[model samples]
Target: MPETVTPLGDGPGSEPGGTPGGTPQPPRGGRGRRTALIAAAVAVVAAVAVVGALGLGGGDGGTGAPPRSGSLVPVTRTTLTERTEVDGELGYGKEIPLPVRATGTVTWLPRPGAAAGRGDTLLRVDDRPVVLLYGALPMYRDLGLTAARPATPAESAPPPAGPGAPAKPSGTAAPRQSAPASPRQSAREVKGMDVLQFETNLAALGHTGFTVDETFTARTAEAVKRWQGSLGLPRTGRVGVGDVIYAGGRIRVGHAGVRVGSAAAENALTYTSTSRKVVVNASAADASWAVRGTAVRVTLPSGTTVKGVVASVGKQATAASEGGGKDGSEQGGAATVPVTVTIGDQRALGRLESGPVTVAYVGREVKDVLAVPVAALVALAEGGHGLETADGAFVAVRTGLFADGKVEVSGRGVREGLRVRIPE
Candidate 1:
């Protein structure tokens, strides 16, 4: 009895007597997987707690390290301001019109596309020795000698005494007043009297229908009235200031008109004004940048450089064209004042009409402004000004006019003459 022991289960390879081909088992695979998952979760929590304690999680985790001090490379900067904007147009000296000489039909007008300059011949007329008839009067005369007229002693008077009064001299002649102008003396006197000579020549030319005088008189008035009547214009009885007349047939030339042409009864001549050759328009707003006498370096569409001097600046605003997209979006605003720049080369001007060009204006510059490297700024985690200091400290700076890899900065906390560090 003492040695006998009951067998509770199957031993080794033998199955339990009461069961048929069955055995008890443990959940080993499931327990191993669960244990591994719990260990991984604990490890993650421990790492996060360590980082928070070390202040490596930023302020969000109520733990952040103090900013470190570092060295910075000091640099100076300038503030550039835009002054004025202006529009410019191109023109050539050849644009001036030339009148036809001798009246036959303008045998040849300069070819449509041909260019000409101040001295270039524009139109040629038929052959005819334009019968040159002197005007009843000319505007100038070469007086052989200076003339003097006898003056009454009473008329020669001394100047009144005053701060600028002349002191009496031993032999100084008394100043004399000019005599009142009379028609008779004026007509006879030829001392530097161009108007009188002009009349004399006209009289000699057999154009006696008019009398010459500086002042338009009844005779000249009658002549003008007659001419205007013949020309079918209102008989205003006044000769236009610069009007001209010829023999063969009558042709009228306006003031400053008719460079090489003549009025012959049966000839047709070209007419042109002899004033300025070209005109340009540009903007007042941009005028500040486009100063007078500025040497403008212009780059044309073909990559040619044309030198020009800014001649005139507009005082007021003017219309201008601005850059725009096909969809009507604008690239920039248009200039208000139109500035005019005169180009010296007539050939260069002729080639620049309506051509693409780039113009740069250098205005006033500001120097010695506090500046920082552009790369030093970091988008802040707190949504505010973000710039890194040389000591690795975070800072906020007010900045302006970013150019040439630097920005102008100024603020209450920022100061000049202070050594600061820039982080690498």
Candidate 2:
């Protein structure tokens, strides 16, 4: 007789051949599941044994060569960067004070948002145009012969030889010392540096025929008269403190300080650079990337990305806004250094004039590093992580920067083009 097979009985505590509805089947279902689980476990053990023979680094597998197939990736040589983004504003940089020096009624002014460039009228005083000049120094004194002193031999003379000073070598004369100035000359003329600065701007405005020097000669007067004639003003041949406004570069009117008809006071209006730039109140700790000449990236309100560079970093720190949960309130706001970033491609900004922008700052980077997919690393029982080869061998690696799903790895065996097995 063939051996009899005991079918899975229904319910626990029920023996084979008991009644058809012998025991509670719900109770029996649990036992049946346990039996199935045991069988599944046995199959898994068999599968693991096969993997051991293939030599996984963490398992008691054979030290065989890496296999030729199965999820594999090659080590790559590339650069890994850690980037951080901060909130920024997109507008003409910081608004600088552009006060007026001309004493007259605000008879005429540029439009509220109008821009001005070299030789352009910023505003009108007594119906005369107040021109714009590119320079760092402001005109504090009139530029005319009255304030200029000649650079004569007396001015260039060296100081007299000190007591007991060594005599000059034979056939070579010593430097002559400058003589003491008389009371009439002791008061001194205006600083020559100021003159040089004024003349530099004067020369840049197509006004030539005079040497750009500290001395404002008669030729310089002639050039000034010509410039005055072009501007439809009285040919005074002199530039007073109120005649022009000195600025770093092209400027755009930002805010009007007073009404159009108001008397022109010391403060006229505020202005900023004409081009759009990004300003970030970066945390003082993040100033490393906020240095001048550091490259960065910017995202516009339209979701467009462009390149930029750090233009300047503020020396002072601003206190963070206190409190929270209110409109414009921030909590634990970090004290920040003002950072100015400028973009080269202005057209890429499209029509975005002023709005919020995101600035990406690079913190740290490792270049020309050998890297592999993070998934390829296996935790070692001994400690740390390792990369398993295809054939069953393992390559111990020292891990570095973890970025963009790739890890920087270096070791005796880690090298570019080396293939490593990845887990499924």
Structural similarity to truth (TM-score) of each candidate: 0.38, 0.67
lDDT of 2 by residue, 111-172 (tens): 77798898899888778788888878877777765533556887676667898998767998
Instruction: Summarize candidate 1's per-residue lDDT along 233-313 as a digit string, tens digits.
Output: 567653332233222222222222323344322223333222212223433333455568876656555767667677666
Cα RMSD, each candidate: 17.5, 13.8
Best by TM-score: 2
For model 1, the local distance difference test gives 0.46
* Candidate 2 CA-lDDT value: 0.78
Those runs of model 1 whose alpha carbons end farther than 4 Å from true positions after fitting are 1-74, 83-95, 99-102, 112-120, 127-291, 294-309, 314-337, 342-353, 358-364, 372-376, 381-386, 389-391, 403-405, 411-424
